[model samples]
Target: MTAMRHYWLATAAKTGAVLADLPGLSVPKVKKVIGRYEPATASFPLVGKGVPVDWERILIEGATVFHLLRDNPNDPAHGIPVWGGMLVRPPRTEADDVQLSLQTAEWYFDGRYVGDKKYTGVGQNLIVKDLVESFAAAGPNGGLPIRVEIVNGGDGKPRDREYQNSDDKTLYSVLQELMGVIDGPEWTIGWEWQANPERITPVLYVGDRIGTAKPAWMPSPAAVFEMPGSVLSFTDDRSYGRGKGANVVMAKSSGQGGARPESTPMVAVDDLRPTFEYRFTPSTSIKDVGTLDEHAQAKLQILKDGSPTLEMVALADRGPLLDVDWFIGDDIGYSIGKSSRSRRQPAAIQVDPEGYAPASPVDGEGYGSMAGLTLDTDNYAEPAPDTRPIVPAYPRGREGVARVIGWELEPQGTPTVTPILYAPE
Candidate 1:
């Protein structure tokens, strides 16, 4: 029997005066809303109209390993050398969420003397040229490089120690020794170096190289993880037990020499879902127009069959508004297909909302809103809107009203799409 799975993913996009009340907030801060389940008397508001909230625990199960090198100095032939060090990743915990961490390390080796008759064990740490080359090779994509520096903490001045040849075998022995010192079960050894303050402190730096190309050691799929399934419904009650408030009217008159025209309430349809209920407090003072009462709540019924559906809800005194806005250019959609014996092939799909006429056809541009494209192997070309090109008739009535412009469905790989809808102006 095929197991039916349900995944709820909801994104709330808000617009209008409700947003105007907030100032200087980041996009994620202002638009994103997290939901929680609690008792009726809980201080936090409820989500979903007429439905009790339910909670599900999410867990992450993945690991990554990093390799690094350090310095060693005990060998007879080579003075100082680079060796591997420890592997590192974020520490997982039950109560806290784990975020990404950046790690880096550097290598330092002891320098040798050329003309001195007596061999002194004390020597300054010097950075080896190969160490730099190794880091560069490992970070071709410009990942944050571990800063490597050589220093001598011994009483001797910097000029007292002679630099060892790059090929010195003694350097290799020193590196091996350093690795042994830091080796352990939980840690993966990379390069190792001496920690004695007198010998020299090797400098190694690591961090998140934001917006930079990733190094080869980094995970292949850039995203940390992919969430599965679709969301059926969502609600937020933070403002007033479901983001409701009293309606207010604003009026103003303009006059230069004569009486000015009176301002009127903006007339527009306020669409609401019947399955959801909203409640708000009334405010006599204009300042309280958008203010919410201390508590809010909502209820919703989960679909039993659970085929997978996406739901989004926003609560506000002014009513819900479509949060869709194009930051880039016009929205478009495409598809890709691959067979066991060949490479993947991509195809564009056409789409059109029910009432609007098909846009002029372009060479490869799809014809519908970004959300209408169906997940299929056949490619569809997007039609240009300006030219008004003739196209196939769209399904009549409300059935053809909305189309999926772009969609993805991959069981083993990452499938993502940006769905956009247009509102009647």
Candidate 2:
């Protein structure tokens, strides 16, 4: 059965009361939605051309919220809420259509700053929660319809940390600066929908990782994507650009009178190659000593491996079909058949359980055939030298366990998803 896309225009309040269940005619003209976990954000375009004239008022910037859900044909009322956020910009009217832009809930923190805020010693999550709460509890004009929640205490990291920044900096920027410190926590503004009670809550999750560590909730078998079947195509990128990609990062921050303070450099030799070092500098807004260390540690975590990223075009929807449903931060395994050519034909098939989904044959020899192929063949028949390309190494061993950093879904026809992946620590 094919899935349906649903859009809702609701009041931008904590209750999130639905103001309108948009009809097909009033829905956005475009169906593409993109979501990211880090710097948690989403983007989609909405047009007023086809929308009902009366609904135009609700499209007013900063007045209403937007939600996109993928509904199963069997249960339309209760659907998988994919992306929910506020309008990022004002409407743009061209010819006859008014174009509107929407972003995820995290955009609320984009302009919010932690001006003149000083802290001697405080937990990072607590500091973040306190800042977010100030916005949540603000006047109606300045408040956001969200609540902060810590899923994991950053793997029980120290709480007595210092953060004192006088320069005007967005709350999101502060979080980024702090999280960039090695071993710091990551946060996201995600949606939670309860069918029976009919409640949708915007939750801010901060911790070691999104769904891992203490108070764990999201748990399932690791998602698997293989070529010749699920994966349509993929690109593996490995970079060693100076400063951009490095195994060693020296955290630096500005001191009084523009003086720069330096911290112990953090190193993680992920690449077997010679040491690649880069000096990490936090924004001038960050003035604390400990915060500088955090930024360096975090920068090292990403630069440590030369910032390896994988982009895969998957031939599947993100629904529950074939148990392929996945969230933003889920650990997934994707393997390209071309990369496993050097391994014995059967060993490659065993590596991916779905079957022998070979990308191409070597010397007109197909790996899918089981006829006259046996374990003994690998032992006795291999007197000839194998010239196949060796399988390239992935982040987590040969199976290539990776985290889903972000994804884009095109649900209009022949639903497809393009997933952005990165190596996880």
Candidate 3:
């Protein structure tokens, strides 16, 4: 019989976590532990307690750290994990701890946002995919830990219609909020990515609510147990007199220029659940006091959840000239709007405004047809199989991809491809 040597599933350096394995371990031992993920934790293993028995047990207040499993522990950074995310707190834990969990990097996103931004200009779905792929791309432990679906059920209603300003609510906050919204009869989100696919998301029975969803070495339930979903859990001896709950907060964008987001990108939908297969440029305006730059320039064809046409209507610019329906001009045609804005049955009370954010900006670069027509790249591209490959999906420019990959508060983030390769085939 051998004691299983200890190891973490992933790195917490990106975001700090609490170490619960061996509480009595001293400063040196703890430092060895903390060094596992992040570089610094000025405020970590925040301890406070009222433990019973022999001595007051200690509680290390920090995130549960995970990182790629290294072949060499001395320089563990080189190694990576196939799948590692903190549970923060197991299902149905004591009332004291709050669960600040992290899902797998593989993710799926749908829904409109302020310019459909998950970051600055990239769509949320794209960003999440990039992240998962990045882990697969680390120097040593590269490649997806395993193929897992990262699911994001974004809010159907988008409040901030403009990517118009650099100072809008952040994508990090939106993602955090998104997780909070999934009311769970299904608390355990899409299965934690495991190296093994045959393993189903296990059921955590009541009581201790311990261990992981399922640990690999775990004995087959049928052999030693009856209920497939139940298991008594055990935790490190950091036992205390009065137990506290776990409430973890995901990290925000780090401002250290080195740590700041390299770029901002995310997508926005003027309408919920993209209605049209084709998407145009957002309203990227440049009026000095204007909001066109803030506008994703994609156009506004959507309405609120259940508003009367008059309650909240998508109208054309009230400017002197008429707003252009690029969708129709290109022969893409309208979806059935009585007016240029709304396809919903229009009413006398509803008013469609005038003027438009020209598909071509007030500026001249948009009209540069020689070095090339930079205008509306989203809707157009050249034929492929030659110097350039054919791209059929809607395009999101470099800025948009950068926007999506940008992480807050961490400058160590890597840069992305310019003019992103459409859907990395």
Candidate 4:
């Protein structure tokens, strides 16, 4: 595969008209991030020492939208518009040099709210769809050309839960609170350009599970990365700090007449561990015992089985392609030094593909070197020793599946991605 050229394009936030191509003055200091819990964001420099006059005129805060597209190596005229978002605020500068920040359509939720609404034993997905559609019906200021998709049990049927938003909290916060419910759906604002209409469409995808878990020629599902190969360096910290252990948890919610209702403490005991208790008091808006108990149980579980964190810097263009091979909620398998059964969730990803290229010509080819190897001892040349390394022979440290929660792209000397991982129970 050939390297793809990446560039930014600007357009009108409301009308979506093609405006101008924005290539920064310098090497284009760019950074983009996608999170499971928050809206996606990006930042790039615009005016500097040698910015073109036309580029300078396109810096309208909150009105202009920018897209990061990767051009087809064979057809430069056509490009794949992968990630895009709106300019959330005014450009920042020191001494006349300017930089702009961006946030995806999801950011619009921060301004819209689900005022005076309450749902009792409602499907989580149904609530999400209803809230989003309500905003879209509000016209230009709040309306967006988004298609709502609910899959994997997010259709307001089965898996019922309770939700109440009387204080008029923003849609963003409401969704965050709803999705944080145990076993609730995952979500993302995915984008794609349509040919017939010549426009970019945002897909508000919500589901019980939102990614692929296919066999990747490894002993596990999802893409696998081994040290001394795709993996570069990693850090493992099992210290249960900050989110300390709490075997006993008490949860409380708001009650009638300015009073707060509380739940009996949820306890988990082990003969070998000491007791650590804490109280969890959520927002006053939450006023149901069922909800409070759920929160309490979830907290107690976390405290009982502390989550360890694992992070690593690996080649971005290796193992799997973003969106295609792995998505925001997909599980990724990685081995550091020895293969031990473990699982981690990707809470964040930072990609800095600036000053570096693939270390070897054999990388980024959609498949690893181990993809085609097979056992054919019969065709043997006792002498026909397998040309590939034994699949189990590669050095593997801690090995387990991890869910991708977020991703980032920024400037670094080498093209790499650092994914923040959290051990999941």
RMSD of each: 27.0, 8.5, 25.5, 11.1
* lDDT (0 to 1) per candidate: 0.21, 0.55, 0.22, 0.58
Q: Per-residue lDDT of 1-425 in model 4, one digit per residue for the tens?
A: 44435677776666566677666622233332332322333444553643546654466776666776766555577576656677766556564555455677677778776755556666778778877787643655646667778856746444443444557677776776666555656677776665654666567888776665545675576566677566777665554454576678878866654477877789886544577777866555666676677777877776765555667777766656555556666777776553222221211212233322211212221111222233334432321233332233222124566666666543233446666554543
- The TM-score obtained by model 4 is 0.73
**C-alpha lDDT (0 to 100) for residue 397 of candidate 2:** 19
Question: Comparing candidate 2 with candidate 3, which one achieves the higher TM-score?
Answer: 2
- In candidate 3, stretches whose alpha carbon ends up further than 4 angstroms from where it belongs are 8-168, 180-425
Off by over 4 Å in 2: 4-15, 23-50, 72-75, 92-94, 115-121, 140-142, 154-156, 161-166, 194-200, 212-221, 255-258, 267-275, 318-324, 338-398
Please report how far candidate 4 places residue 265 from its true position, in Å.
Answer: 2.3
Give the worst 10-residue stretch by lDDT in candidate 2. 31-40
- Candidate closest to the true structure, highest TM-score: 4
What TM-scores do the predictions have? 0.16, 0.72, 0.20, 0.73
For 1-425, candidate 2 gives per-residue lDDT tens digits of: 44445444454444565656544323322222112222222222344433544565556676666665666555666565665657655545444444456666666676666654554456777776776786444545657656777877643365444334445676776676656666666777766664443656677777766542212353323566766456776776666787657877777766654477776777774424587878756666555666677777777777765656677777655422322356666666655554434443432222234333322222222222332222333432231264543323321113355666556665445656776676532
lDDT of 3 by residue, 77-181 (tens): 332222233323233344543233333322211111222333444343344334333332222523222232423333222222223225443332333322221
The best candidate by lDDT is 4
Q: What is the clash tally of candidate 4? A: 8
